[model samples]
Target: MQSVADGSQSSEVPNVLGDFALHLSAQRGLSAHTVRAYTSDLEQLFLFAQGQGVESYAEMELSTLRGWLAEMASRQLSRSTVARRGAAARTFFEWAARTGRIEQDPAARLASPRQHKVLPTVLAVNSAATLMDAARDLAVEGGPADLRVWACVELIYATGARVGEIVDLDVRDVDLDQRSVRVLGKGDRERIVPFGVPAAAALRAWLERGRPALATWSTADALFVGQRGQRWGQRQVRDAVHRLSAIAGVDDVAPHDLRHSAATHLLQGGSDLRTVQEVLGHATLATTQRYTHVSAERLRSSYQLAHPRA
Candidate 1:
């Protein structure tokens, strides 16, 4: 082990950052998945640099960073994945520099890989309604899948929230009297999103008639519980959305599509961009503006359909 100025030690043969990452995760409150990814990414970089006779991160140069990027591209990694790796590297190096382990940050000037600006696809109002209707019918059957499926579809479209946010919701997060649900969005930011009467009705049905039947002693306070009495995860919500979309004749619909549908419909109903931003919990207004484009496209199609003159 080579001791560094920061009172830290690095393996002379390379590849030991995984243990450091676990330490950061277990002690520093980092998410487990994030810790795993960051550790794996950093370990790869360290090994590559070591293969070139560079002992520590401080010995890295701009060319070495670029070479790593080229290696990622050669492996057919997506632009977004490469970009995330770059970010991870930058974060790790910054921490190293701060702790005196590294004298300089090699990733400071590393440009983020340009990602494709793929716009999200959304369902039309009628199509969304059809999906909700299917969910309702399924739930009325009183099966566990039906109850969870109904709530997933209804709440997602109603609040336009990310699936993670919806799954993390507690029973008390919803306010029936106020017609709002409190959501803890990304970065632990809390926002209140209002749901319409239909969504409220669906939620009421699930809470009153459905949830109790599925509730168990170990069931957490989560608003959505699985058949095993665990809280619903993002994967479960995605599967439910996929099934409901198929029933509605839209097999490709995703959880995010409901978010798009909400924003588009809100704009079409004359809501302003700022209001949409707040409702969607967007940190920037620029993100909410995309819905305006979707709304404009819908308006053009409507105009073409109803126009008397050719």
Candidate 2:
């Protein structure tokens, strides 16, 4: 409803946005998800700019950027989503300036609201054990399918690897003898994550008894294969996790929750922050620090439940 620009100043907005997207992918090597998210936010900005009568990336002043954010806030958007949009704007303008698409970065001094921090959801230690126990129970009573499910859940929680990384795994990525698994993380970064004996044993059983029945010529390298012998999909892994939860009588959780639980459990077990960061393949130590908070919260909960004094 606000009109900051009265006339069409530039029509190169779409073209510059395309170039920005290419830079994000080819030059920056950001993940597809990250690239898409950034592009989506920019697209919304372009729409807002169109309504404001601003025409080009170079013409977008700090007021234009602030106005765009203010508009989103007026719409009552979540702070995290709004914060992400602010980040996208900063990234776009910086790239535009660096690549000479724009004379200067308009978002240089733009200040966006910080995202509201929410604690990650994690399972308690006993609940995690119950889930694994249920997975094992199913594997014992059932065939290759159950064994594969057991192995998938064990490996996910054990390594704190993202489901995308887990589904992308190759048979060669695992080393049973050394108890370590090579996880290719975001930005194509690779790291070795060690698992406990429980995970190793489950992996061994799946590799020997389960994967053989599912592997085909095309899926020979795939560590976890689907029913028709293609590489396992993330959806399939999620389904397995849900099924395990129902059977285990624990609260339902997704694969990422398992990752959160694993990180928290490692911290509770006395693993240092750096070691947990390496295991999770986080780009920053700050991301890994959240698990320490989860552990502290649990410690407080335990003390409150046990202590008699007010």
Best by TM-score: 2
Find the number of clashing residue pairs for candidate 2: 1
Q: Model 1, range 172-256, lDDT digits (tens) per residue? A: 9999899999998754578999998878888888888778777777765878888777887899888878877887776468898
Among the numbered candidates, top lDDT falls to 2
lDDT of candidate 2 over 1-310, digit per residue (tens): 1222433434465466678788888887788899889987887787687678876656889998899999889999999888999999999988888878779899999888988778888998999999999999899888889999999999999999999999999999999999999988887889999899999999999999999998999999999999999999999999989988988999999999999999998888888999999999999999898888888887888899999972
lDDT of each: 0.80, 0.88
Where does model 2 exceed 4 Å of error? 1-15
- lDDT for model 1 comes to 0.80
Error of model 1, residue 8, in angstroms? 15
Residue 285 accuracy (lDDT) in model 2: 100
Q: What is the lDDT of residue 178 in candidate 2?
A: 97
